[model samples]
Target: IMVLLVLIFHLLFSCSHSLQYFYTAVTRGINFPELTAVGMIDGEKFLYYDGNTRQAIPKVDWIKNNVKPDYWTSQTQIIRGSEDRYKASLVTAMQRFNQSGGYYHPFQWMYGCELDGETGATDGYSQFGYDGADFLYLELRSTSYVAPVQQALITKQEWDVAEAERRKHYLTKECIYWLKKYVYYGKSILDRKVPPQVSLLQRDPSSPVVCHATGFYPDNVKISWQKDGQELHEDVDVGETLPNHDGTFQKRAELKVTPDVWKKNQFTCVVEHKSGDPIHMILTEEKIRTNSAGIIVGLVVAALVLIAVVVGVVMVVKR
Candidate 1:
């Protein structure tokens, strides 16, 4: 029965899904974020702290529901700790890692840790990233790390022991049972569909034209720029599709061109996603706005002009 359930969960939850950072913060004595992945299972991440999403800020609901009961309350000795402190440390670590004083960490994007302290370990698998119409483009795990260093430091015997411990502590627990159940609950959320918004951007007349696509789902997307019906590869800079806080993704394709070429040629930004047909964008003055204010101002000015024309026509008729 247990075997069947595990297989069922593994099948369902393993797909185009959410970007979850499952973490176990131990704030008792040790203040460092744990880098334990039990042999680095599905784990990778790049977080933006100061950005619009404020992803650095941990979800209190997740902390309270999952981290609190599973890890904190499961201790045999009941050594109480502070989840609040742990949450703060998590946010702080995200900030420090993202925006350090002087040092730069080339790698350290996606991050999640299983708290093995007082709480019983995060049971089962977690579905993050795509919530409702969100596309977590990449797996929310760190793909590149100190692999050579880990190989040098961790011996075979040490590895065998750690694996044994992980299996014993993680696989055979009641948490595992609950985890599969939770995955079942989150299956629909993970599979939710979201469409992308395509737009063209350019700073003044001399700058390169940028094509942006934001808020898409299922993560399987491709965006590229084309001119004269031929895809241009030279001057184009296609960015990696990245996750948004709402679970959607954002990608930008840019190209540098002469002012004459920019004004004359009708360049296209084409996006293909799982939900539907390709979304196409062509750069034009009427279609492009730098920000929401530009849109509002344009609307307001147009409205005032319309009002003036209506009043003038009415006065002429009266006269």
Candidate 2:
């Protein structure tokens, strides 16, 4: 789940800048919020509101430190209004789908805008989903809402061009304004780059070699394996980037090879991050953690420490 979230985060922030809002409404559920809203800037969640909380709160320190209290109050009121509307919409959607009884169904709305910081170009998107399927989406080029499912055709017909125009205006203009403002507010943290700590790990001599890189900021990283200075795409499994507890990112790529192949040829795990030059960790028996040799070394050290403690106790007794 953490990896999934981090992957989404990485994709969201792939562009130069972005501001997104997500609203979810559930028809019925146990221990689940009926309505919830989240606001994200540059892929990082900054504001969150739920039915239980009934208040819009900042999720990040930067937002709390930069945004005014009244802003939160205003956002709370806005989300409260949205909650009522979304709840009603959920019912309407269920009715359209001819669904009844106490079944859990979710209606989601997402709208966002992206800005290319380098080229000054922008893009906008608005989409709605029901029961984990695409229900409707705004066609920015045509300035109209498109219904993907039969049940949503009614909504598409009802949503007038004026509404679509208003959405477009908000997505293209207002959303970009807020995105830029948020970027400025969180520039220090958003723009900063931190290098990753790379290591070679193995469960045992026969296990795959894992190139683990963690504690990297910005979430953009590349990890690959090379055999004899040539990239090896086969027998390599690259895991998804996962979020660290401290907002950094981590990723790992495993290389499956026989001990003979690795020992005979030069195999290297290369990690590329925006923070600095690429890190290359050559595969060697000594560099791999949890290998047979490493375990033996650990046991020897522990036994020596125990013997030293026992000898010291004997000398103290003699004294």
lDDT of candidate model 2 versus the reference: 0.78
The sequence of per-residue lDDT tens digits that candidate 1 reaches over residues 127-241 is 1111111111111132111212222223223434444445345434544454444444444544565788887776566767677777776566788878878888988888655
CA RMSD, predictions in order = 16.7, 15.2
In model 1, which range of ten residues has the least summed lDDT? 310-319
Query: Model 2 misses residue 192 by how many Å?
Result: 1.1
For all predicted structures, in order, the TM-scores are 0.48, 0.74
The pairs that clash in candidate 2 are none
Model 1: lDDT equals 0.44
C-alpha lDDT score of every prediction, in listed order: 0.44, 0.78
Residue 225 shift from truth in candidate 1, angstroms: 0.6
